[model samples]
Target: MTTTLPEAPPAEPGLKAGLKNRHLSMIAIGGVIGAGLFVGSGSGIATAGPGILISYALVGVLVVLVMRMLGEMAAANPTSGSFSAYADRALGRWAGFTIGWLYWFFWVVVLAVEATAGAKILAGWIPAVPQWGWALIVMVVLTASNLVSVSSYGEFEFWFAGIKVVAIAAFIVIGGLAIFGLLPGSDHPASGFSNLTAHGGFLPNGPGAILTGVLMVVFSFMGSEIVTLAAGESADPQGAVTKATNSVIWRIAVFYLGSILIVVSLLRWDDPAILKDGSYVAALSSIGIPHAAQIMNAIVLTSVLSCLNSGLYTASRMAFSLGRRSDAPAAFGRTTDRGVPRSAILASVVFGFVAVAFNYLWPDTVFQFLLNSSGAIALFVWLVICFSQLKMRRIIEREAPEKLVVRMWLYPYLTWATVALITFVLAYMLTDTADGGGRDQVVLSTLVAVGVVVVAVVRQRLGRGAAHDAVTSSKA
Candidate 1:
């Protein structure tokens, strides 16, 4: 005898299929390469030495697994809410409400961080504009793009992400050549694979530092899931999601591991320049690339702008998704004639501008508060995806077996293992005050998460009470 699962609720209203396959492709490839990778890997290298490779590999595996689970659900039933919508079906309303808000909060905060980073770069290039002015300009321009139409956002990201991908690919090819002494300007005496072993012998800080390095580099992997979210807006949501999911492994390997390997190989992890100039620029300058700092600054700025553009789009969509479920103001769910969620987009940009103001007015205290509170949200989101998939997989298998276009690698086992791995990371984060900020991030973010969950529960209970009242009155 065969048992059947109950039919899953229909997915929320689908968004415009304005994103083309190319847009989705670039977003998948370029989303993972955040501004953090260009600006922050130096610290990871400084922390883990050549051993940072292992750290990246470990996190890369974790992300690949999480994306696989997310892809499975997304492919089966595409929705703008993405994992949050899946959670609502597979988990409960509270789960959806909590994660959706937290995810929205995370991106709005990111908008400020990327805006400031980009503004600083623009100000340096054209000192006439103040940093805050530049920040306003970028935020307005990107917001307009998003408000215009989904295709406009896609077009902007296509070029923005294109520049970043080209820059990284060029860096890898050129840096690899310089390592083998093939480039004409490969005059840096210290460049080669030897640097990997010569500097502190690769595991300079011992095995524990790899875990520490994970804490440092884990957040850089946040944007990989954006593709899963963007897939909902594509012409072929399932196909786009499946393709993006399959390619995630190579994307992480080539863009992240490949680039970092070049950095450590081109210069010993302990080099002063690596610490001073960041990993990418130091690697370029080592090979005597002229104006290396300027070139890197341009690339980094492109990354920042790409991040800001996507951040707004991602946040608004999440808001719109939340609104559809009565988890937020109903206004957020309505779209303009162009199919843009105008209210949601404007709401997100408004908060983002406020966060940007907080950064400008009190960079140390208020901004850090905002940053720390949202720091661990990426982990929270991944955890939700894992749990949602665990149930979603079973639901799809029983009800709509044909929908499983993108299956998780090993079904229940891998899904559970991914959960355990994420749990371990969160546990380590809580106890490892050695990381200073990591501990605070966990504690503060947990507090914020707990607050949101409490709201979800209250809302759920009140909703139930209202429904009960309506039923009783109808019976009367």
Candidate 2:
């Protein structure tokens, strides 16, 4: 007699395959390009000087390698759980459970942060509304958009991302011209890459600043992996993943590194403008554009909203996938009549609201804690992907190598190198405290990492006990 395995539960219905190729493409482009680049690049540039370009390039290469590994896995088995599911199949149930919860935790925290940030911007534009009120409005609107259907979410993201892409492209083009002294009334005489060496000679803070910059730059690339997650629901998972993986490198190089080059070139490394105003906003304003702050504020608002919308969708789908795998409560796996994971969406949104409440009542304490605690999960998630792909590639090669069309280049060599570099970065982050911000990042990331390890161990023991009980009952 043959022993039979249990059947897997059916995938929840109502998740419409409404997201077209265009939506997935734009989302892949937009998800990686967050408000952080627009707002946070200034600080990196100020610290690293013109050498921040090298910092972005370094982080970009890491992202490219990570995404390629993820694409290889996602193209083979397109699922919402993404790296978590890959970890399960390639590594073990414990790896899956840990990374899934970690990734989920990362996004829910981000939902709160982004919502709060967007609210502040809106509140400034219309002071009649309270900040919390703006937060509520932003959350509700985006939640509804997600609830309508994934297609609706994709459509909204398409336009949101379109605006950002256009803005960045134009900024790059205009800024490039201004740098070359081609713009009207611009007698600055093509800075000719002199800004890079003029101040402290590139790497002024020493090569250590590049390593320090890695911590922030890595986080900026966090959302880029979402493309693989969303691609699973697309009509053509392999094609989508392939295109996204292939193009993302150049995109990062051009948009992120390219824009930073322009900013530092146009303005001195130690200029008060770089410190006082944001990178993009300051660059535009320096060129004598009117209402530059307001214009960039609106763009940043859109980027924040887009991120929030994607956050909700990503968290819900991840929860839904976890439920389907029995790693989470079964309720999360169920869908509404329209195929939406209503419970999952509502659960994630409720947490977002709680975060918002904390932001209002204990702005400095509870909210700040949440932000710090969940800060390092992105690194955890990427590390898991690297390991998963290392294991999964062989399995795929054995079972069906043809499916490995989008394989990670150079296989285990590059994968291991990426892992080593990430480990080094983490180690560096822990030790380097040239700035207060870096020290805080190290402490918070360490705490989050420790918490994830503890959870993984407990979950593993519990799973083993459950398995043992089942075997004993069957024997009886």
Candidate 3:
């Protein structure tokens, strides 16, 4: 006689599938393009010169591999918690708790970062408003949009992302034409493919600078995984994940590598204005575009707002997921009548507001430290995704082969290679000279990661102890 098994508890209701296909498409595109690509890339160009293309290529490939691994897992079990949920299944509660909280922390800080970045531009346009006030206004508007409903958030993101996509594509096409002396008003007779090596050779700063460029630009790629998280809320998660995964290659090749190739070719990589004004603006100016700086500033502002909007959405969803798992306050798990995670969004916005305050009060001290402490978390998150995929693939194969809608290219081999490459980048980051920002980022980020690890370990142990005690009490 077989013993009857106890029925499992019903799963808690989660975020509504309000995100549409167009929303996912734009999110996938916009997620990969951030303000860093517009503004921060100038530093990388200065550091690596023309070799920055190689740097972007390396990091892009790394992201693609990581995303492939992530897609394999997410397609199998799409959820808003994303890799955090996979870590729970593949590693343990400790891994899940640590990575989830760490990721949430990263984005909350990013909300502050993006808000400040956008505020600077807004304040530039209208000096009547203080920078902090602009930051406050931007944060309040986006938070209200998110709180209203997930669809509202998606609608905002869709249009914001669409503008970015069109802007970048247009830039690439016009710049490419200018490089070949085809654009009508582009006055640069010297512009051509030779600009790549004509200056001081392609690797002007030497080959080592490529790795330095990697360290500088890798963080720009941080938001690409936002697609996987957003997919869980889409109408068809598996399909969305698969489409996003397949599109990663072309998106990186075209949007990043293609655009950068045009920029470097049209203007000398060593142009002083590239660093002073920005790479995109300098490149546009080289093509004789009127008001290039103003145009790029507008694009950068759009990107900053886009990043801020997505950051709030991602952080709140992670919090909501944690709540459902009992890893956070239960209030975070509750949804509004319209399926909005009101408490979760507000909780995320609270930290964001505090961060904004810290920015105003301690812009150079505590806020700077907070920025550094979370700097390397993108790499850490990607590393966790790699490891989770390693174990998750096997579990998926054994337990639910039919659910494997997306598959990693080389299985464990390429997966292991991706892990090795990421480790190398991290190790390189640690070895960066003290004068540069790399070493500081690694050290501060490590400290923050360690603190989170300690919390996760303690929480896991206490949870296990409680479970054991409950079992004992039931036996009694």
Give per-residue CA lDDT, model 2, range 1-476, as digits (tens): 97332222234354666779999999988988988898888888877777788889988999999999999988877778888888877777777777887788888988998999999999999999998899999999999998878888899999999898999998889888888778887555577678778888988888878876777677877799888878767788789988998999888988898888888888878888776878787788877777989999999999999889889999988888888887888889887766688888988999989988998899788887877777667877888899999988987887788889888999899999999988887777777565335456658866776776687778778888999999999999
| lDDT tens readout by residue for model 1, 180-291 | 8898846866446998898679999998889889998999999888888788788899999999999999999999999999999998898888879999999999899999
Count the clashes in each prediction.
Answer: 0, 3, 0
Ordered by lDDT, highest first, the candidates read: 1, 3, 2
| Tens digit per residue, CA lDDT, model 3, 238-281 | 99999999999999998999989988888788889989999999
Name the better of 1 and 2 by TM-score.
1
lDDT of 3 at 124: 96
The most accurate candidate by lDDT is 1
Give the distance in Å from residue 466's predicted Cα in candidate 3 to where it truly belongs: 2.1
List the lowest-lDDT window of 10 residues for candidate 2. Answer: 3-12
> Can you tell me which runs of candidate 3 are displaced by over 4 Å?
1-12
Q: For model 2, name the residue pairs that clash.
A: 13-339, 14-338, 14-339
TM-score of each: 0.97, 0.94, 0.96
